[model samples]
Target: MGGSTPTFGFPRELRILSSREYRHVFDSACFKVHGKGLLALACPNDVGHVRVGLVFSKKNARRAVDRNLLKRLTRESIRLQQHRLPAVDIVVLSRRGVLELDRQTLARQLHGMWRRLEKDVKRAADAKTSA
Candidate 1:
């Protein structure tokens, strides 16, 4: 297996780690995408790569297993779609009903959310440049 493959790994730099980083994205989020099971917030970043943060709160899923499952689904979806996503900081917040959904359903929803968010980010970026 080659290490140069973009799809082969989810690197640390591509993740939104630390409370400060998460707070920055949340406080400065430029656009938001709301899906049935998730809410995605996007903020432009100069890092030249897409970064994602997942928030599966206790209120979203009471059980630890359910929270873990939702986080896994969110992370997997983001990892697979990282290339397609815009160069922005994105935070995905899982909603209460997410735990009851199947993996396929959740993946589809997350993918759709990313696609829409990407478009919004691109539009915002374009507008900023044009202005």
Candidate 2:
């Protein structure tokens, strides 16, 4: 164990716990990225790293298995891409037809959304610097 590998773990600090945190993002999201059946709303955070929350309602997923699958996919995607994301609190919402999508499709959609968010954050930063 001479060389250490970089870890990409989803710790509690990387999660958006509590209804109040979710509400804050829903109410004041500065960036929004929409995908096939997923939407990611994000707002800048002072914690200096990205945080994620999932909102997969029963009306959308319909079954506990389906909901858990969606959460797993979403969380895996976030864990892999968290290093590239800006310091923001992100809430990912699933639409009614999300379960219809295959796992690969859903993963691709999430990846695209994360890329869009990164671009948006960069654009905002450039604007602020130029101003």
Distance (Å) between predicted and true CA of 126, model 2? 0.7
The TM-score between candidate 1 and the true structure equals 0.90
- Give lDDT tens digits, candidate 2, residues 43-87: 999999999999999988888999999999999999999989999
Number of the top lDDT candidate: 2
lDDT of 1 by residue, 10-42 (tens): 889989999999999999999899988789988
**Ten-residue stretch with the least lDDT total in model 1:** 2-11
Q: Cα deviation of 39 in candidate 2 (Å)? A: 0.6
Q: Using alpha carbons, what is the TM-score of model 2?
A: 0.95
What's the alpha carbon RMSD for model 2?
Answer: 1.6
Candidate 1 regions exceeding 4 Å error are 1-5
